[model samples]
Target: MAILPKLGRAIYVLLGGILFTHLGSYMLLPFFAIILSTEKGLSLGSTGLVLGAGSIAFLTGSLLGGFLSDRFGRRLTMVSGLLIRGAGLLGFIWGATFPALFLTNLVAGVGGGIYAPGAKAGIAALASQGTKTTAFSYRGVAANIGVTMGPLIGTYLHTRSSTLLFGGAAVVYFVLAVSHLLLLERDCIGEDCPKVDRQGIRQIFTDRPFLYFSFVTIFVWALFTQFALSLPLRAAQIESARNIGLIFTASAVLVILLQGTVTRFFTKYLHPLGTMAAGIVLIGTGLGSVALSTSFWHLVASAVVITLGQMFVMPTSDAIVADLAKPEQIGSYFGVAAFVFGAGEAIGNIAGGQLMERAVAIDYLPLPWLLYGALGLLLGGAYYLLRLWQPLAKPLAPVMEERTENNPSPFRPKQKT
Candidate 1:
C-alpha cells in the first residue's frame, strides 16, 4: 500500500474503534432512564440517583486512568477498559435488579472513563504534525455516525426485548475491544516514559493555561449536555419516540456531513481561538432558537443548528489539547478534558433538571431554553477572553525514538511552556 493509503487505513481503524464504542454506548444511553423507571420498577428520582452514581464513577476512573495510561501504556489501559465495559454490559443484562443495575452501570462508566483518555491520546500520538485538527475532525465524524446508528438500532431491538437491546450493545463493545487489540499499534507508548510524581501531577492542576482551558470547556460541555437533559422536555409536543430519534439523528447527520469541511474552513480562515469562539456563538444562537420550537420539525431544525455548532467546537477543542500537551502527558491532558466534560454533564443534569422542573411548575416551558442559550453565549465570550489572556503551550517536537529497548531518556529537555 502507498503511504497515504496506509495512513488512511490506520485512521480508519481508529475511527472505527471510536464509532463502535460510541454506538454501543449510545445504544443504551437514551432509553436507560426509561428502562429503570418502567421495567426495573424504580422511581424517577431513584433512576437519577443510579445514573448519578455512574457519573461519579466515571469521573474517578478518568482521573486514575490518565495516570495509568502514562505509566503503563495507552493500549493496555484502553483495552482493559473495553473488556471491563463489555463484561459490565453482560452483567447488566443478567442482573435484573436495582443494585445490580447500579453497580453494573457504574462499572461500565468507569470503563468508559478509562477508555477515553487513552483513546484520545492515541489519536494525538498517531496524528502527524499540521493534521491534528483534521485528524480529530474524523473522530467527530465517526462519533456522529455511531450516534446516528446506535439509538435507532437500539430502539428497534428495545421493542422486541430490553435484554436483546442490551445484549446487542454488549456484543458491539466486545467486537470493538477485539478490533482495538488486533489493530491498534503499541508504538505510541515509548520506552523510558517519564513518570509524574505527586508534585508533578499537582503541577498539571496548577498549570494556568491548561486550567483556564479546562474550566472554559466545562461550560461548553454543559451546553452540549442540554440536548439530553432539557431539549426533550421542551419538545414534549412530540411524544413519539421515533420523532425524538429523528431529531437526534438529524443532528448527528449534520455533524457527520460537515465536521471535516467546517474544521478545514476554520483552520484556513480563522485563527484557532477565533474558530472556537465562533463555534460557541453558533451554539448559543442555535440553543436560543429552541425557545421557538413548538413542533417536531422546529425541533429538528434546532437540532441541526446545534449540531453545526458542535461540529465546529468538538474537534477544535480536542486539537487545542493536542497542541498544548507534551507527548507523554497527552493521556493526562485528555483525562483532564474528560473530567471537565463529566463534571459538566453531572452539574448540567442537576441544574437543568431543576430549571425544567421550576419552569414546568410555572407554565414557562421556554425558560430553561433561554437560560441555556444565554449560558452558551457567555461561554463563547469566555473562550475569546481566555484566548487573549492565556498564552498557549507550544507544540512538542516530533516523536523521538523509543527508549524502552536501551536508552535511558527518550526526550531532550522540556520545551519552555
Candidate 2:
C-alpha cells in the first residue's frame, strides 16, 4: 500500500511482466526434476548435472545480460531475453532425452539470466532513492503472487498433460515478451547512459564490499534453491504431488501477505545487514525443521518459516545492491547478483542431489537437511559479523542527486557546485 503512490505506468508494466514471468517459470520449473527422474528415468545425479549446467549458463548470461543492458538499453535486453526464454520453454515439450532436457535448460537459463538484471535495473532507473526499497518489495510481492498461483495451476495441468503444462508456460512468456515490446519505455538514452567499457567491468568485479556481500549471500541462495531441488523430492517421499504444490503455494502466500509488513518492520528497526543476517537464520531454522516434518501440514509449516525469512532477505538484498551501485551501473550490479544466484543454484543442485541420494541410500533422510541447516546458521553468523566489522555503504547524496530541469535523467551524475 505504501508503494502505491510511487507506481507509474512503467513500473506497473515492469511489475506485470515480472509477475507473469515468474508465473510461467514456476509452473514448469518446480516439477522439472520430478518429470526427469520419474518419466525419463534419469538418476538424481544425472538430473542434478542437467540443472547445474543450466545454472552455469545462467551465470554466463548474467554477465552478458548486464553488459548488454548497459550498452543497449533495458527494454531491448528484456524483450530479447523473454523471447529466448519462451523458445526454451517450448523446447521442453519435445525434450524426452537427457541431452535434450539439458539443452533446453541451458536456453531457458540464459534467457532468464538476461531478463532478470535488466528488469531490476529498470526498476532502479524508474524509482527514486526514497522509494527504491519499497518498489523492490512490491516487485517481490508481485513475483510471489505469481508463485502462489503458478504451482496450483501447474499441478492440475501436469496431471492432465506435461505438454499442456510446458506449453502454457511458453505462451505466458511469449505474451509478456510482446507486451514488453509494445509498452515498456527505454530507460537509457544518449549520454545519460553510462558507457560500460573494460574499466567499468573491472571496477564492478573489483568492488570489495559488494563482492563480499554477494559471496556471503551465495550460501543463502544455495539454501533457497532447495525448495525446487530437494524439498519437492522430500515431500514426494511423504506426500502426494498435489500436496507438494500446496506447500509451495503456502510459502508464496505467506510472502504475499507478510512481505510488506515484515520489510517495513525490519527497515525501521534493523540495519540492512542485520536484517539479512536475521533473515538467514530464520531460513536455516526453517530448512532445519524440515528434518522433523512428518506430514503435509508439517511441510507447509516449515515452508511458512522459510517464506518469512525470504520476506526479510529478498527485498533487502536487492535494495542493498541498488544502494551499492552507481546509478548508471545498476544493471551491472544486479547482473553480479544474478551471477551469484546462478552459482549458488548450481552448487545447490549438484550438491543437494548427491546429499539426497546418499541420505536415502543410507536410510538417513535427515542428514542432508541437518547439514543444510548448519551451513545456513554458520553463514548467517558470518554475515552478521561482517556487518559489524564493516557496515554497508549508504547511498551518496551528491552522486545520486534528484532530477532537475537541466538534468533530465533522474540518475544523471550531479554537477559540481
Candidate 3:
C-alpha cells in the first residue's frame, strides 16, 4: 500500500498511453473497405463484414474481461490481454484476406475487451478525496486523445502500405505488453473494488439502470457509426472527403475539450438519471438534425451537438453503474454495458455498409433513415430510463465519499475513452 501512491500519476499516464495505442491500431479500419476491396477481390460489404465480426468479438471479450478482472485482479487481466492482442496482430500481418481478417480481428477484439473493465475500475480504485471525477476525467481525456490520434496514425500508415500498417500495430502492441510487465504491476484488485457473491448474467439483467444506460450506449453508437461508414460515402457522392474529415475533426475536438468539465459538472449537480436523459435528448437532437443536413456544415453542427451529449452521458452512465453496483459485481456490470455497445456497433457498421453505400456507383438513402430511426429510439429509451429512475434513491455524496474512502491509490486502468 505504501508503494501504491508512490507512482500514482506515472501509472495513470502509462494507462493512457496504452489506450492510445489500442485506438491507434484500428484508425485505418474506416478505410479498410476502400483499401482492400480493389486488391483482395472483396467488396465493400465484405470489409464491413470482417470489421463487424471483430466488434462482436470485442463485445464478448469486454463482458468476459469485466467479470474476470473483478475476480482475477487488474494486473493479470491487462497483461494477459496485451500478450494475446500481440499474437492477434501477428495473425493480422500473416493473414490478409477477408476470412483471415475476420479471424484476426476477433482475437484483437477479445484481447482489447478483456482489458476494459480492469482499466476503468483500476483507475477508479486510485481516486482520492474530492478528485475521483477529476481522476476519471483525466483518464477519459487520455483515452479521447488516444482515440483521436489513432485515426491520424492509421491514415498515415494506409498512405504508406497496408502490410506496414498492420506490422507496425503489432510492434506497438508488443511494446505495450512489455511496458505493462515492467511498470505499475499490481497483483490484486484495489482495496475498494466491488465484491460480489456469485455474480452472474442474471444479476446484470436485473439492474435496470445498467440495462437502460447500456441501451442508450447502443443507440448512440449506432447513430454515430455513420461517420465511419456512411459519411465518407455521402461525402464521396458530394465529392467532399475533406469536408467529411473536417466534420469529424471538429466533433473530436469538441469532445476532447469539453468532455471532462461536462462530465464533472453534471455529476456534481444533477442526478445520474437526469444526466442520462440529457445525453439521449442531445444526441437525438443532433441525429435528428443530421437527417435534415443538406450541407456539410449542417452535419458538422450535428456533430458538435451530439458530442456534447456524449461528453455528459457516456461518463455519467459509467459512474451510475459505479454508484448502483454491488461492489463485488462492478466488473460484470460494466462489462455487460460494453458488450451491448460493442455488439450494436458491430451491427451498425456491417448494416451501414449494406444499407448506406452502393457498389456500382449506386447510392442508398439508408444512412439518414437509419440515423432517424436510432434518434427515435434514443428519445424513447431516455423516457423509459427516466421513469425507472424516479423511484430510485438519489445520493449526493457517493462521489465525494468514494474519494475519501479510496484515497491514496486510484491508479487502476479504466476502459476505452
- Using TM-score as the measure, the top candidate is 1
The total of clashing pairs for model 1 equals 1
For model 1, state the Cα shift of residue 238 in Å: 8.1
Error of 3 at 375 (Å): 3.7
lDDT of 3 by residue, 296-315 (tens): 77677777877787776666
RMSD of each: 7.4, 6.6, 7.5
Query: Each candidate's TM vs. the true structure?
Result: 0.87, 0.83, 0.78
In the range 199-307, model 2's lDDT, one tens digit per residue, is: 8778988888888889898888988888777888888777665667667666777878877778666655566777788888888888899899888778888888888
Tens digits of lDDT, candidate 1, 322-346: 7777676778888888899888887
Rank candidates by TM-score, best first.
1, 2, 3
Error of 2 at 152 (Å): 3.8
Give the residue spans of candidate 1 off by over 4 A.
1-8, 188-193, 237-242, 362-364, 393-417
Model 1: how far residue 313 lies from native, Å: 0.4
